[model samples]
Target: MTETPQVTGRHRELLDQVLDKWSLHVLDRLCEGPLRFNGLRRAIPVVTQKSLTAALRRLERNGMVERVVVSTRPVAVEYRITPLGKTLQDLIDALLLWTADNLPDVERARARFDDASAVAGGE
Candidate 1:
């Protein structure tokens, strides 16, 4: 009998990192083009400066985003998708499409789960 391979902790960790809200938003914004810090903040209005900063730093460290200093007078930095990041574009688009197609079903399932959990005092 052949055994099936299990997903390692590292794979789960990487999935968590890539699928986070901030990472997805950052990647989506960068898909349009390279953007400065303020530009990214504008594109993702709900993200706090500190959170965005952290997200960008993590993405840069993960080799998914590139940070370039393009100006020196007052100092300016821009974030762009690395080749690896660009490869994720199709995955992101698939996620978007799946969400669009199944959001209602997901919401309905959530509502039902919540109701059941409430009745059972499990929520």
Candidate 2:
């Protein structure tokens, strides 16, 4: 019998860094192509400048994204996914596909949990 490997603290921290709310969105956008800060904001309208800045910094720190200076005159910068980050695209896509495929099952499970909770609350 084979046992599943346990997730360590570093594993959880790395997952949290890449899979956080804004990180995924930023990655998805960068997967399309490089974009300036404002362009990224426009692409992901729900993300505030502050959140986007924080996410970009985190991703850059993790070597998943690269920030480039396109112009010095106006001080323009663009963000692009590094080769390392591009490697995550396939996995992310697979996860999305899995979610789509299993959404009905998930919904049913959620319904069952909610029903049980309601009954317990009534009791």
Candidate 3:
């Protein structure tokens, strides 16, 4: 049996910031290549502008993504995954594959839990 290492507050904070819903989507999109603000919005249609902006700022602060100024004429900007962010690719791919493989089992577990909860209470 492998013991889990201690997760400090800083580690938890970083995970919360980087692994949030919008952050994950933003990171995945940026991984492909550089994209302008509008381009990112279009790529993630469900995210509001405010949410996307916040996610980008958090990613930039974490050094996982970079914002570049492309033009002064139209005030263009683009976001791209930094080398640091690229390091997450293999981990993310493995996680996604794991989820795909285990989703059916997860669904069964959830169904059992839900049935138990319903029998216990309305919640």
Candidate 4:
């Protein structure tokens, strides 16, 4: 019997950090061009300020997003995708496509599971 290779802890941690809803949404918005904090907020209107800030900070810490402080009166700052981040674009796109393809089946399975659980509990 052959054993399947398991994902490493480090890889799992990285995926948990990057695959979060806010992080994915932020990355998708930044795919167009650099955006200021306000711009990002506008682009993703439903995200709370705290959530956006945390996501951006995490990305910046991971060296995926570059934060530039422009020398202006109010100290304008902008966030852009780093080279590493650019590399993730295709991976993100592929993941999106995969999710789209699987979502219907996933929903159906969830509904079936829930129905079975309710029936089992009633017995």
TM-score of each: 0.87, 0.89, 0.88, 0.89
For model 4, what is the C-alpha lDDT against the true structure? 0.92
Model 4 segments more than 4 A misplaced: 1-6
Candidate 2 structure quality by residue, lDDT tens digits, 13-58: 9999999999998998899999999999999999998999999999
lDDT scores of the candidates, listed in order: 0.91, 0.95, 0.92, 0.92
Residue lDDT tens for model 4, 34-113: 99999999999999999999999999998889899989998999999998988889988998999999999999999999
**Clash number for model 4?**
0
TM-score of 1: 0.87
Return the clash pairs for model 3, or none.
Answer: none
- Write the number of the candidate with greater lDDT, choosing between 1 and 4: 4
Cα lDDT tens digits for candidate 1, 75-99:
8898999999999999999999999
Q: Which residue pairs collide in model 1, if any? A: none
What lDDT tens digits, residue by residue, belong to model 3 across residues 84-118? 99888787777778989999999999999999999
Model 4 TM-score, 2 decimals: 0.89
- In model 4, which range of ten residues has the least summed lDDT? 24-33
Q: Which stretches of candidate 3 lie over 4 Å from their true place?
A: 1-5
Best-to-worst order by lDDT is 2, 3, 4, 1
Higher-lDDT candidate of 1 and 3:
3
